[model samples]
Target chain A: MFFKIIVFIIIGIAGGFIGGMGMGGGTLLIPLLILFTQTDQHLAQAVNLIAFIPMSAVALIIHIRNKLVEFRHVLITALPAVTASVLASLLSKRVEGADLSLYFGIFLMCLGVYQLVSAIIALIKKKKSQEGKQSAENKRELSENRQD
Target chain B: MKKLLKKVVVVVCSAAVGFVNGFFGGGGGMLLVPLLEKVMKCPVKKSHATAIAIILPISIASAITYIINGYFDWTSVLSVSGGCIAGGAAGALLLKKLPTGIVAVAFALIMIGVGVKLTFF
Candidate 1:
């Protein structure tokens, strides 16, 4: 129990930091809890959800203050995403530990790839918009020179 | 007046965050936490804790929605939540001691992961 407490704390710190940054902390927490606490996977998943209650609240408050949040988008996506998560939770009980970890790892890797890609896309789009604006300005200047 | 407006935004945002949080299952909390930290100017630790607090009502509401439609596993939620309460406190304290930068990078990595999962996986 004492050892578990120590491990839990370590996991928590790591998870909290990861969680704070908006990474699915469960990627770290679920495996760590299972390994250290020797707890059941379902329990770990449930614990992950429950723990998120507090963990997320703390983080959300900060994000709210910073105005980085998009409430409308959140609403649009919430139902589908929550439904997926709940459905996944139901199915998780039948899964094996290693299999679950593999799936989760794949999920994480895929998620990482997506973020990198989207950020690139967003950046590219921004650059294009800027270029478009500059070209428009150039055209305007040319017209003014022709008028003169 | 601005404070009042901000409060309204917070509630609406929080509700949306919660609802979306409930939908994603486990991770919208991560999104909300950092948004709180970065956008809302909340301290890192407080943002995390607040994310959880905001999530509860949303989860409950969503869970009820699930339950009405017969989607929940009461047994699973009970078991996992039981262990998580204790684990969370430890995680919270542990979070307090770590360097902020390490935490931030890890989060960014995770976001990248989430983005991948959402788009490709």
Candidate 2:
């Protein structure tokens, strides 16, 4: 029992760390729980949802303290977000467990691939711009030396 | 007209994030930040910070439904939450030091593997 508790806490810490970093820890948590701990897919999703309450609260407090949050916008987003979340929850409840996991998996894959490709492209673009600037500097230096 | 259109965009975009988060749990911030930044003209930092704030209520709404629906594993919840709070503190503290780009890449890979396993296997 003690060992199990320790394991669960460790998983939470990892998830929290990722989430706190704004990496969407809850998304990763579900699969980690299911793959490593053999937790049921639906159950992992529920636990992550519960844990997010506190985690997000802490993050929000920090953001608020830093004056990063804009309340007027928050109000606009929050109401619609809450309503849609309720509707989504209702839909999720109707989906069977296997299908739920499958859907979740598909969502992740598409998002993941998209993000990864974007990141790689961004990196390439940055490198290309740097090289271009460096070569431009080299050309300028060559012209100055030739004149001298 | 343009102002009202932007406000409407905010609601529509956030609603999409909310629905996905409500269905899955724990990932609306990604969708929220860009929408707020582009549609609402919020700065990136403000968008991220606001996304965190927006997440809390939506999470509560989703979690309540999950609880009522009887999907909880109390033991995991209690144990994990203990770690989550502590880890959140640590992550926040280390926010300046970490390279989020690397983390994002790693996260993407993990998601790919997990998604494949869940779907086909």
Candidate 3:
């Protein structure tokens, strides 16, 4: 039992770290619990949701102190988000655990592909911008040499 | 009219974010961060911060639903939450020192690999 608790804590640390980086720790947490432990899909999901509350509350406090949170925008998005979340959570309870895990697997794959693509795109954009700056600097150096 | 359309878009998108987060039990912030950054023109850090704010309430609502439906397990919740708190602080501190693009790519690859294993095996 102690060993099992240690494993769960390690998993939580991995997920929390990702989440702390703002990359959705729950996405990784649910899968890790389901795979590494004997946790049921629903239970794993529940753990992710509950664990996030305190973790995020701490981060939110820090962000608030730093003046990073945009309160006006939060309200606009939050109302609809809350309503939809409640309905979806209720719906999830009705789904079978195996089926839910299968669906979640598919969802995770899709999100991974999307993240991969976007990250590559961003990398390419960064490279192009850097190259543009280098060429512009080279051109300036050549013009300066001609004047000298 | 354009402003009204933008508001409509934000509402529709936020609802989608909530639905995904609720059904999956977490991840609303992933969808929300981009929406805030691109659609709402928020700075990256601000979007990340605001995402936590938006997701916090939605997560609480979903968690309540899950608990009401009898999904709560005390041991797992306590253990994981404890670890999460510790690791989250470390991650936040490390964020500034890391090269985000490379980390993002590595994380994406890991997600894909794990996702494939879960789906097929």
* Best by the DockQ measure: 3
Tens-place lDDT per residue, model 2, A72-115, is 88888999999999999888888988898899899889878876
Tell me the deviation in Å of residue A40 in model 1: 3.1
Docking outcome class, model 1:
incorrect
Q: Tell me the tens digit of each residue's lDDT in model 1 across A1-148.
A: 4565556566666555455444456656655665566655445545555555654554456557866444543543344444544554445545665565455555546555544554456567768999999999999999999999
Error of 2 at B70 (Å): 1.2
Record all residue pairs in model 3 with backbone atoms less than 3 Å apart, i.e. clashing: none
Highest-lDDT candidate:
3
Off by over 4 Å in 2: A121-148
TM-score ranking, high to low: 3, 2, 1
Once superposed on the true structure, which residue ranges of model 3 sit more than 4 Å away at CA?
Answer: A136-148
In CAPRI terms, model 2 is classed as medium
Number of the candidate with higher lDDT, 1 or 2: 2
- Ordered list by DockQ, greatest first: 3, 2, 1
- What overall lDDT goes with each candidate model? 0.54, 0.84, 0.93
Candidate 2, residue A61: Cα displacement in angstroms equals 1.5
CA shift at A130, candidate 2, in angstroms?
A: 6.1
* Per-residue lDDT over B1-121 for candidate 2, one digit per residue giving the tens place of the 0 to 100 score: 9889877888888899999998887568777877887788888788888888888899888889988888888789999888988887788778889766676778788878888988899
